[model samples]
Target: MPVAVITGGGAGMGLAVATVLVADGWRVALLDVNSTVGEAAAASLNSNQIKDGSEAQSLFIRTDVTKYDDLRTAFATVADRWGGNIDFVFANAGIAGGTDFYNDSDSEPQQPSLLVEEICLRGVVFTSHLAMHYMRRNKPAPGGVIVSTASAASIYASPELPLYAAAKHGVLGLMRSMSLQLASEGIRVNSILPGAIRTTLHTKTIWDQFPVGDFTPVEEVVSTVLGLVNDPTATGRAMEISAGETFDRKQPDYCNETMQRIMQGKSY
Candidate 1:
């Protein structure tokens, strides 16, 4: 069976993706910070397998993606259990938004919390780093696919959450840079950009503020992710899923001949 690891797979789009992958017979390992939810998700998937008269097809590892040891051990555990190779990885764990930059209530000036960037940006970077290590083991065959969860805020400005925007933007940069290098080694890299999906990411009150027509469905995002996983040539793409449609937001070409030459290293 094909083996996959999905961080943040306990709930939201991550769990949904795991559900689809499990149904399709992929052996999956879910890495999440919540033990209760992660274990339950794995059990639910395993229960489905039992109904199908097959062995359990899912496992959950309690992983704090921000920590190297936690992620490293989790990756190694998955590789050891399923074999030495991993076929796919979804670096999809994220927090809703960063703390308000100007909202501190203490009399003294306080240092800002970077937990938002740590989880959103650094989590993705850490996940992708270990993903490459195990995916490389698959050769004789082409290396596996790596998909990170980037937000639409990755490209657009979000004045209300500037720090969150910055971290997600970093995810976009990482995906593009990794794809340029990894494609030559037969590994595809891509990202999903979802707009206004209702999950635990935000409160119901917050979600209610957006127009119903403006909401993007989680299923739409899942479809885009699976599209990338199944397509051999779909890499370096930041696909935006909004209002039931999918669009590959294209990056611009160099502005002029001189800049193009410099960009492509044809000029100094």
Candidate 2:
């Protein structure tokens, strides 16, 4: 069976993905900052796996993504339990920046703080770096893939949430770069930009703004994630999921002949 690691896998789309993968014979390790919910979520998934007669066992490790030591320990725990090979990684943990700078009062305008950058951007970078280490040493072949949960803010600027937007944009940039750099080693990197899902991050006020039927289902996001993982030809791709719509976001390929030539010249 293939082994997979998922950050923020205790609830929402991450947990949904874990359930699906577990049913399909994937051993999953869920890493979340919330130990209570994380352990319960893993137990629930394991129950389902047992009921379905799957031999796979799911593990839940308490992890704070902002801490590199926590992330390293989580990865090590997964490796020890499931062996060295990690077929897939979902770097999906994130916190919503609740301040809307554009609509704020004159007292103070909210801005992207260090914590926002640390978890949303830096945390993802750390996870990806560690994933590459284990993926290169994967069993069978070196075919490993990483999928990140960027937001719709990644593609379009979120005036109300500039900090969140900027952090998500950083994730997109990181995903694209890793895709290119790891392609030669059979490791694919991709990101998903989801719009307004009714997760815990969405407050009641925010939920009221959208129509009753407009919330994108978590299952849709999970399905897209599975597709990206199984699609061999997919790499450096950004999938956008919103209410009643799903499509790929096209990005420019900057590595033209001119840039290649310039890089070659610099190689001397």
Best by TM-score: 1
State the RMSD for candidate 2. Answer: 2.9
In candidate 1, what are the lDDT values of residues 37-103, reduced to their tens digit? 9999999998886335677599999999999999999999998898778999999999875476768
The lDDT of each candidate is 0.90, 0.88
Model 2 stretches with alpha carbons more than 4 Å out? 50-52, 100-112, 253-268
* Model 2 per-residue lDDT tens digits across residues 157-210: 787777888899999999987898899999999999999898877678878988
TM-score of 2: 0.90
**In candidate 1, residue 209 scores what lDDT?**
93
In order, how many clashes per candidate? 0, 0
Provide the lDDT at 175 for model 2: 95
Off by over 4 Å in 1: 50-53, 104-108, 257-268
| Clash-forming residue pairs, model 1 | none
